[model samples]
Target: MASPGIFSEVRDPSERVRQLCNYACKVDIDEAIPPKRYLRSGLEMMRMAKVYQEEGNYESAFILYTKFISLFVEKLPKHPDFKTAPQADVSAIKKKVVASFASAEKIKAKLKERYTAIEKKRQEEEKRIQEELARKQAEEEARRKEIEELEECKRQEAETKWLEEQEARLQELKRQEVERQRQQEAAAAAAVAAAAAGINSGAPPNFLNNQIPSAPPGNLSYIPNDFGGSTKLVDIDSQPAGTGPIIPDRDLKKNLLINDGPSVSSPLPSVDRTTKPPAYDHFMSTGSSSGNKFGLRDVIIPSDLPRKFLVKAEHNTLKNIETCGILAGKLRHDAFVITHLILPKQSGTSDTCVAEDEEDLFLYQEPRDLITLGWIHTHPSQTAFLSSVDMHNQYGYQAMLPEAIAIVCSPKFNETGIFSLSIERGLVEIGSCRQKGFHQHNKTPPLFEDSSHAKTVDTEKIEVADLR
Candidate 1:
């Protein structure tokens, strides 16, 4: 018979199976039951089933246990230990074992179902988290784009306002200039009319009407006169009497009568007025021919060339010549210094060529010595560059000024053009490198070849100007 603890005492079926399988071979049975018969007995068969169950062969163990229970019930037990050799109640034991097996199966099924449900929940939670993160990222990206667009709009609006203000200022300046020109024309007409009236009235032509007092006759001596009666007269000479004028004694005639004055034919000998006269004779000397005189005077100094920022040369020599027109001025009085070369508008293109206004140019003065003589241009295309005409022009320009620089801006390549001359030595082929920062090497082919063997080209030098 099976052990009593197998089902009645063992709370865990798995533990019961382990105990039975371990003690199965040591259990002693009646010799009336042959050894082979004993091994095949119901008790032994049940132990074998439990061993199979412990080994994870649940289907085989369940079948073996069912058959053993049925056989045990059909064959009654006749053990000597039984008081009256009561027949074994195998039906009840069989029912209990079948119920344990069903319970184990149900437990296994519930565990599998729970595991599946947990895994599904975990996947759903992970997906939710990922979706939330994506949503936040998208929201942030949208906000960033919105802010950028707003900033761009604000910048564009400010630029538009600035342009409008500049246009208004330009219009007002043009009106003022027109008014000034009208006034000038009116003044000129009035002067002409006055001259005509003087001629008609037979009066002496008063060409000196607007002239101020003249300076003294000597080259170094200055004359003093009351100009608007505001400044005091400062006499520059202090000397003894009868010494003659300040003019050197070597040439008396050259320093005497500067013009046909009233004292030209006076009988007094020519004497330098710089000599001191007697204190008592001061009043009398005032009326003498050599006394102080007054007349309209003009002081003239050479004018500077008009300030410009661009000059085009026709030949290579001309292009190389350093011209004042191409120089840029230094910053003066919080003003900007800008230099630009404008090209004519291209034909058939609706685009208008814009240039910096004269008002902007008037804001600063350029340095006269740092002028750049850029390339010349004809109306060939709506561009500015060294064409054959430009090269010829540069050759001529270079001959005049060897240090001149040239830049040719062509519309064909838009912003890319040839700078035939660099402020530094050599030509720099400027084109779109599509890069940032300073260029370390040239990207284009050399425009000119060396004069030596002619096989290799000596590119233009790139260096900063040594401006003192």
Candidate 2:
């Protein structure tokens, strides 16, 4: 039972390929084309495929054409009806299937060409982004190296200064030691002279020991010197002293201007250099399995559509009566492009218009594979806005497909607007309300807003089927 209609909603291209395979396996080929209206309905796929191709929706066109070949060229011949059918019917079917095979092949070639160009452009863009990222990375690396070199040079300069200060302190300490040596020599010479005087004058030699002063307590201490019987003063303060008041060093290591490494300098800010390819629109969607909450895809409205419909419905407008038309089209490139504006047989009053025979609309759409995207109507004398009645009417279309829209045109007010019921609020309000025609409802959080998913385009001319 799987058919082209099953693909009306947006789906991933890969999933669709799998679906096609599964469909082929499960399909009962013998029962595919049943008797009664088989001959008439057999051509429906071809008709719809031709419409897709003519409308420039190549993806949908290609799919329909392929399906047509699968059904008629491959499946129909195996059907029970075909085995007992008249020779003329069989001959006619064979001729159409052969022609369809040719059309499908032609469209396949076009699709190949279209996709090849798209892929080439995408690769070029990707290469450009990669090149840009590589260039930036190189610049960051060079900057980091420059900072490291500068910091190293500063560290070397600081180390050299510290060494020079230590050398000077060593020289100063040697000079101080020499001066102490000279003083000790003088004191020893005086003691020896005194001892000689004491011996000559018959005084005690012990007086010489008393004349010499004891060394001071603290970091300073005296030791025996190489010079005659004199004690050399050793500056033990050159090393760290015993526990007492702390003495400041000639050079404090913490205050020295030295660079440890690159960690000292500010690090470069991180940048996200990765880039992703553009999303494939149209028939390709990576949407969730739950389906698009707002429905399939963008619903395209033909530009100046309101004006065109107005021209067709001028008679109704002149009489101060309303006119309505069905906005219908095939899915193209993940969008429902409104290609046909059908003025279905209908009657109207100054405020509202109703289609008389809806069956006529469905009958016309069946063979063409058209989906009802939305509706457009003219409010001859009123302003371009949906009324309470209009809200209820639009709720039905939106309920069927969340992407559906309602376009309101008012020639008298020189206004035309595309609108849709608010899914969050409008749909709920209208769905619950039972009132009819021109009645008021809570308008604080208004029921509808301008359509965001629908856009007017001028790329293709819209076909008007004025069934009236």
Candidate 3:
């Protein structure tokens, strides 16, 4: 509460002034409550304005100093005791109020500069973040476009293969129709001959008893038993000579070397169905069954193609760590050969793990010149072999390109292997496997074949710009 007489009803000019003086002299200037004396109360406010100025509350301090000057200094000369008060004391309070306002203005200037600097820094940081986001978005879009193009190429390849196979089937059907018609015509001619000779038309021809000229192994000719209706693909390779005329539906026969107009005599080499394909990819120009599927030219690799991976593994900080990358190449007229071996940024380890990155610098290096053919990896310490993880990786590669090959090099163990899954066999089985880590799988007919010949190196050297 205020002091006793601060709000009293005393109104005498001299008597009330003495009472007010008594109240002013007894009031504590430093107390939390305001003093009854305006002089001391205004002086205390001037000190508080200095504190507010240094604390960066410039506006608040300026307002307080303004109120002190208007209420106290404007009324200083009106005070009855002004002549008795020290002139230095009055000057000191005026100087202090002026200093407080000046300091508040200085703080305002500093705050303006500080705020401007903060805003500029914030804008720069925001721009940097936006730029980073744009970069990542562009790289992601590029990778997505690459994946779409690869998928489209695979779709076209599959469609072409399907069309070729359909054409082959249609050709086979036409050959069968021709073969059947030839038998019917031959039967009709035999019937005419028999009837003209005064013999039964339905009876078997006498030529059936006499030995006829044997047809070629592939283009076998047959005369039906008087009535010709149905036809069958003949497997003359399995049939013996003395048992009957051997009929063949082998590739040579399916090629339809038949007597559409006149019969041609061409010898056919015997084929062994049990023979397996070569351990490595090589030109199969024998024109045999194997040549029908793998007719493309043989893939070739140079001896020093993998020197970069070896050198990189040796010089990097983690000497014993595993390394992996994509083998990029292109398809020529007859062969698919490696033109660039891209070392994409990845998280590799001693035995396993090759994490993929969508924004990898290598993804943009190929542009329109290269194609991702397969994968390559180093085992650091272990001998070369496809682990379960390797199987999963190569499965994706082979799906994109049938001729995709896997290369496993062990720099420390001095081992290297180039291989591909045998048919849609082990790799196919492994693709659907639920197990993780290394494990065994039971597969027949062998799982893989050596594909070392498919690799080759170009004169172009590895560029740091490409790996960045």
List all candidate RMSDs to the true structure: 55.9, 10.5, 40.2
Error of 2 at 424 (Å): 0.7
Q: Write the per-residue lDDT of candidate 2 for residues 217-296, one digit (tens) a residue.
A: 24423222222222222344644433112223434534766545454333455563422112211112212111233444
Give the C-alpha miss distance for residue 447 in model 1, angstroms.
90
lDDT of each: 0.33, 0.65, 0.52
Show the lowest summed lDDT stretch of 10 residues, model 3: 281-290
Tell me the TM-score of each prediction against the true structure: 0.23, 0.52, 0.35
lDDT at 393, model 1: 39
Candidate 3 lDDT at 30 equals 18
Q: What lDDT score goes with residue 92 in model 1?
A: 41
Error of 3 at 16 (Å): 99
Error of 1 at 289 (Å): 99
**lDDT (Cα, tens digit) per residue for candidate 1, span 252-364:** 22333223212212234434323221122110011111111111011110111111112231221133322212222211111112233322222211111222342232222
Winner of 1 and 2 under lDDT: 2
Candidate with the greatest lDDT versus the true structure: 2
